[model samples]
Target: MGETDKHRRIMTALIEALIAFFKNIAGVYVSGNLMLYYEEGNPSACVSPDVFVIRGVGKNERRVYKLWEEVNAPDVVIEITSRSTRLEDLGNKRALYAELGVAEYFIYDPNQEYLKPPLQGYRLAQNDYAPIAPDAQGKFHSAILNLDLQIVNDNLRLFNPHTQKFLLTPLEAQEAVEQAETENARLRAELKKLREEK
Candidate 1:
């Protein structure tokens, strides 16, 4: 309820990029702001993450993810953080993810005022979580997702170093298509004029 506009925007962007990037991959499920019930029948042992990815599972929608039934906890979990949730995100949530054996845990403070670096990550190792060190460019590499997590212009961004491009959100993808169409139309007109002149 206390989520800001930036938090919501970042969450949506992550969700869009994850879907677009992983849609063709088999057994990859991405979701946001969903209840992950760790205990099979105990509703109280649940955590609602801002964004999560579970591998080796069907990509179908679920009202709530039951870990026992799925046989896998989220491989990656990301939180769009705020000052109010700082304690929870860094403390309880961190412990819970480690306990659940989430391979990667990331938190991004889009506002830039809450966290010192505004982006941080942890990787589960030997049942304990280890800090994920940022690279020279300040991007934290996600081995599970095979992507780099960073902040771009005050927003959480996923960059694919392999493609040498940042994964686009849904709106950004739409804008790219529109821009390409416009450029193509202009080039077509110019080509017709050149042919007529010749």
Candidate 2:
């Protein structure tokens, strides 16, 4: 349709891709543009994070997440920088998430104009979020999720330290499990043949 609609669609696709990728990993939940209601003064003031994660939340697709229903704010909230929303994301949105007691805050600039390299992270301390140190590779670790945020090949990717592997999507995780089971069965059969020969 219009240019704005096209941009929104593109962003939505990107968000969905990231969420799907992160869901393949165990103990992580990624949501995008999920409405987070806070105050009652103005419904329009509701916040929808571009991307967020809550570890150990289990694997499931959610149509929408209500803050009051979830009983906890997201552990990590990521904001995708855009021309119209860059200022708000860096300012009001940051303050709002901090006041809500979110554990971590991340900002990314897909345009790569204002925020070059396009990734920043902050960890909540006491009543506010303090800047977090990025690793030598310019990747930031999430204390809450225990994952690293890295820009790989111009796209933000989630790195799982426990598995020392990049998290996969739901389908990928399923396939991986199946593949492992098949390999294990093959090895077991080979071992049985060897024992018989002995």
What are the candidates' C-alpha RMSDs?
Answer: 1.9, 5.5
Winning model by TM-score = 1
Candidate 2 lDDT tens digits, 104-173: 9988776577675578898889978798889898889987767788777656667878888765544556
Off by over 4 Å in 2: 1-29, 40-42, 55-64, 169-198
Candidate 2 lDDT at 182 equals 100
Report the Cα lDDT for residue 158, model 1.
Answer: 97
lDDT of 1 by residue, 1-198 (tens): 557777888898899899989999999999989988998768899999999999999999899889889998999999988878988999999999999999999998887888888899999999888989999999999999999998888778999989989999888899999999999999999999999999
Q: By lDDT, who's the top model here?
A: 1
Q: What TM-score does structure 2 among the candidates reach?
A: 0.69
Any runs in candidate 1 off by more than 4 Å, and if so which? 187-198
Tell me the TM-score of each prediction against the true structure. 0.92, 0.69
